[model samples]
Target chain A: MGLAERRRILELQQTILPERERELADICGRAIPYAVDWDTFADDAEALSLLEYSACHRVAMALRVVCRDALGREAVREGLREVAIANVADTSAMALTFEGGVLRLRGAWGQRSAGMFGDAEIGALLSARL
Target chain B: MRILLIALLASTAWYGASRMRGASATRRALRELGHVAVPRRLADREPEERDGLALFAFGRVPGSPQYMGSTTPYAERLVVAAWTPTTRAEAADRALRTVALGVEGLTWEADAGGDAVAVGTGTYEANMARRPAWVLVRDDSARGLTFAYMAWRRDASREAALRTLERVAGSFAPALPTAEYLALARARGGVR
Candidate 1:
């Protein structure tokens, strides 16, 4: 699918999601600007840290399959990877993406918390296949 | 001169020990995800792990690290991550909220025999497009849970990445951790 087409899908999904969910997302979105720069940590364990990070969290992926009119079949891998982090709220993010089958992830972590993605880890995830 | 020489040796020794520990732990991480062989060649040459699975670092140094279990046939997640690249804290919570608006369900976990998929708290429209990531995951029995670890990003070129990630997710099986593996991780402030 193309960018234009994807935008259309996003619009549709936005409509379907419950208002409360949207409200939560909006709340999270709103608090971002208020983030204080106190939860910073050293990124020295770049490699081992990601693994350690991975071990502490749980991720789930969702795909919305699409197809065209043809002899072959097309599947829009529409799903979400609910990333589970070890927290009181059992908080985690979702890895939701599509394009030849790669589900990338964007997440949220609370202030003074250690569940956020590091620079190297984020880059690898972006560069990764899904 | 003697003191300087001893200091240099001590520094070298410290570096070696750290590297050894890092490599061993990363291997165990992959093994925890069920990859048997621990690779040690990311230093000397190319990595010896599976083509689509391994521990990848940005360069020879450490700034941030990512443990990649495997790639799914999905894409837009990466593109989404491109736009709001907040390397610092505070913005992550908002990022997740923004991205979560699109993809909200479907996490994979490890099954006893292999892997299985679970439908969790997804807040998506059946026909919606442009999500953060798409996963074909399974239940992880060993870890006593479903949906282990993952990253979700947002972007403009989302459609392209989505198509690709789906393909990657299809041609593989979900993985679960071993008992010893979970125990080890939990021993170090880690949990399943």
Candidate 2:
């Protein structure tokens, strides 16, 4: 899937569905390939924004899978969104980028695996086939 | 003889100047956090410890040290820090994430206070490479608590660090933040 195609699916997911987990998972499953299989996102400012949003939503989904509680999942999303917003696009040490045919994150701390993608949880989820 | 005297004086002055870098406040903070056993040898050594920790009070005051701690080998270290959020729920959410990450799964439970979450790494004996590190992130409106310690050798340092954190937190009474500190802390939203 391509960026345009992924965006289309996201639009559909937002408009058509009643925000169910299984449905959201199906949409994300289809969109992962397009999101991760890209290179040279260097110049596109909009792509960066989309990637950040997608990353946040996907991470929340992953947390929901582990948490299994709607309230807890919502809390995680709110907390993560606060982290994402406070960091900002330019100033945040953590940011979404593309390089060498895969998406990358910069300026994370802890074990290479821990902060390898700025947010370790997101990195783990994105890297996995799920 | 005159030249030797001048050289000795210069070297002594340099040593005195270098020692001054560890300010009184730093010493006081460390002491308040825990006692520091200063080593006998003070030769050429890295300014910060290989496994070290420090607290940063976000603010505009020059009182806060510009450089709180070293940033090298961030992976080998774990940091427990606090950020003043508007509500207790927000703080609990932040604590939950830390707990989830520590246990590497979905197992986390908040304590009775609703300010902290507890999680454990079980044991590292099975995997020698896994450093035994534990994290506790707590939010008290006046003062936040973040407890982190790394032990690679199964030695005394790890236990000492944990004990110190517990003692300090038990007696914690944070001073009221100045107006400047509050404004700057709000602007700086994330925990260090």
Candidate 3:
């Protein structure tokens, strides 16, 4: 996916959907749960494209696969490692490694203000994925 | 010649005694701030208070240079700072700007629980020298405070520097009781 297209998808996932969910809750006079389906982008290429735009979400999904599907762990790790290697030349780019069921980032992607996802959003995304 | 030698000896003694005093003062101040298992070789300078933050700096002896100079070959330094009335994110940003200055290609990670954040980077000094540095920030939400620990070492592997930082972080204990600190903040009208 192109950068613009990926950004549009992220806008829908991050802003539009949440706003719509909030509107529904307001109309119903109670809280409503909205879940994002990671399987929608099941293809590795498409998922990797989204990973560039929304890393923490993709990482959370990848981590969920690592935790629940023992058979898929190696594949997920390989995919993430590929991503890490591809971005090795970008000094400011975020890098990550998964070992012993722990996820580690190579840089302060979370502290950056450049459309990076936050921890709360990661938790919500993970919950939806699992 | 005899008088000159005696003067030189006296000056050396004074310098050694001052360094010892500074290390002891640093340790006392660190104890007051919180519980940290300071390494025996990590001699410290006196704690400095500036703009509501307490800065405690330490460096290894025998080869460590004085106060983070650029000339030391096998130098190592650790700094522990506490910033109050700030969130973890704010503290992390501030530490990056202040403590991690001149570092390049920094990588950061926050724990799965979101309570701790860490940044690792390398510093380039004179003669194209590179050293590893790690900063770990932990939040105490009850007191609206965040503690940042930074460790850097020249001629040391990244793994070793990170291990030193993690060791200090693992052994730290907060000095103030949560309830007591909260009560004091309330009494002072600092917290609602």
- After superposition, the stretches of candidate 2 with alpha carbons farther than 4 Å from their true spots are A1-130, B1-80, B85-119, B122-128, B142-153, B156-162, B170-175, B178-180, B187-192
Candidate 3 TM-score, C-alpha based: 0.36
Candidate number achieving the greatest DockQ relative to the actual structure: 1
Kindly give the stretch of ten consecutive residues in candidate 3 chain B with the minimal lDDT sum: B23-32
The residue-level lDDT of candidate 1 at B64 comes to 15
The i-RMS of candidate 3 is: 18.0
Which 10 successive residues of model 1 chain B have the least lDDT summed? Answer: B75-84
For model 2, how does the per-residue alpha-carbon lDDT over A71-126 read when each residue is reduced to its tens digit? Answer: 54343333321112111223245555433333444323111112223234553533
For model 2, residues B135-165, the per-residue Cα lDDT tens digits are: 4344445553453322222222334434533
In model 3, the Cα lDDT at residue B131 comes to: 52
TM-score of each: 0.20, 0.27, 0.36
True contacts kept of 3: 0.00
Best by the lDDT measure:
3
TM-score of chain A of 2: 0.26
Question: For the second chain of model 1, what is the TM-score against the true structure's chain B?
Answer: 0.25
Q: Which candidate leads in TM-score?
A: 3
- List the global CA lDDT of all models: 0.27, 0.33, 0.43
- By DockQ, the better pick of 1 and 3 is 1
Interface RMSD of 1: 8.8
List, residue by residue over B1-192, the lDDT tens digit for candidate 3: 999878865664465334433432112224223445555556666554444444556655333223235444323456665555533354445644545544556676645454545545555342333555565555545544444544444334446555555566556655443333233223323211
